[model samples]
Target: MLIKSLPSTWDVEITQAVNGKEALDAYRAGKADVMFLDLTMPVMDGYEVLENIQKEGLNSFVIVVSADIQPLAQERVKKLGAMAFIKKPVNPDLIESALKQYGIAL
Candidate 1:
């Protein structure tokens, strides 16, 4: 739904993953420039994905978009190399801020 809400001019592409493994597969396949990850995904979690990405040296930027707002979780994701963390119920300002910080202007 948030993807659809983004402006068409942004020319953003999206890929769907039922779980973190698929997300990792897609990342390995060079399918994205930046990824928005949910920490509580099934099959594998975001932390696992982050670990795999770091291990494989994939060059995609990651932004965590999860309901898990715990300080430990945020710090862990940051340590794992996520570019930013955005909480759930994401607002436009936050989204824009993240994108702009990454140099992805809409």
Candidate 2:
């Protein structure tokens, strides 16, 4: 869905992570500019990854895309440095809306 949502006018290189741990490692290596994260996963969860990123001062914008969509979860992720919180089963419209909300033109 994310791939299908990529703006035609924008060009970007994507890095895929299989799990939370790999995601963290990729960020540590400065491989990500924007991250679409899942709250639940093996090894490390999104919360822990976000915490680690904050502590390490990783310069990346995070848009959490998770199945957990409770208000508490949303608030928690926002406080933990997530720029946006989006629910799972995402679509092109949702992706575009999120980008626009964050003032991303492309």
Candidate 3:
């Protein structure tokens, strides 16, 4: 549902993943440019994914979408290389604003 809310003008391919591990696999397959990650997931959480990305030095913009809105969680993701953090349930307007703020264009 959140994926459908993204603007058509963004003109990007969307790769859906059911778990953090699958997300990482997709990233490794070159399907991730801007990743919308959920911190809670099975088979590897978003934090672990972020850690792996950092450890592997993968170059991809990550925007964490999570229900855990605590300041510490936000700060942790930033330290792990997430470019932005969006609280869930996601607001499409905020997503667009974040993209613009980061100068991401398709």
Predicted model with the maximum TM-score: 3
* Residue range with the least summed lDDT across 10 consecutive positions in model 3: 1-10
lDDT of 3 by residue, 1-106 (tens): 7797686699888899999999999998888889999999999999999999999989969999999989999999999999899998888888998889989883
User: Residues 1-106, candidate 1, lDDT per residue (tens digit)?
Assistant: 5575454567777998989999999998989888889999889999999999999888969988889989999999999999998888877678778888878877
Model 2: per-residue Cα lDDT over 42-84, one tens digit each: 9999999999999988886999998997899999999999998
Q: Whose TM-score is higher: candidate 1's or candidate 3's?
A: 3
Q: List pairs with backbone clashes in candidate 2.
A: none
Highest-scoring model, lDDT:
3
CA lDDT of every candidate: 0.87, 0.86, 0.92
RMSD to the hidden true structure, all candidates = 1.4, 1.6, 1.0
Model 2 residue runs over 4 Å out of place are: none
Worst 10 residues of 2 by lDDT: 1-10
- Evaluated at residue 35, the lDDT of candidate 3 is 96
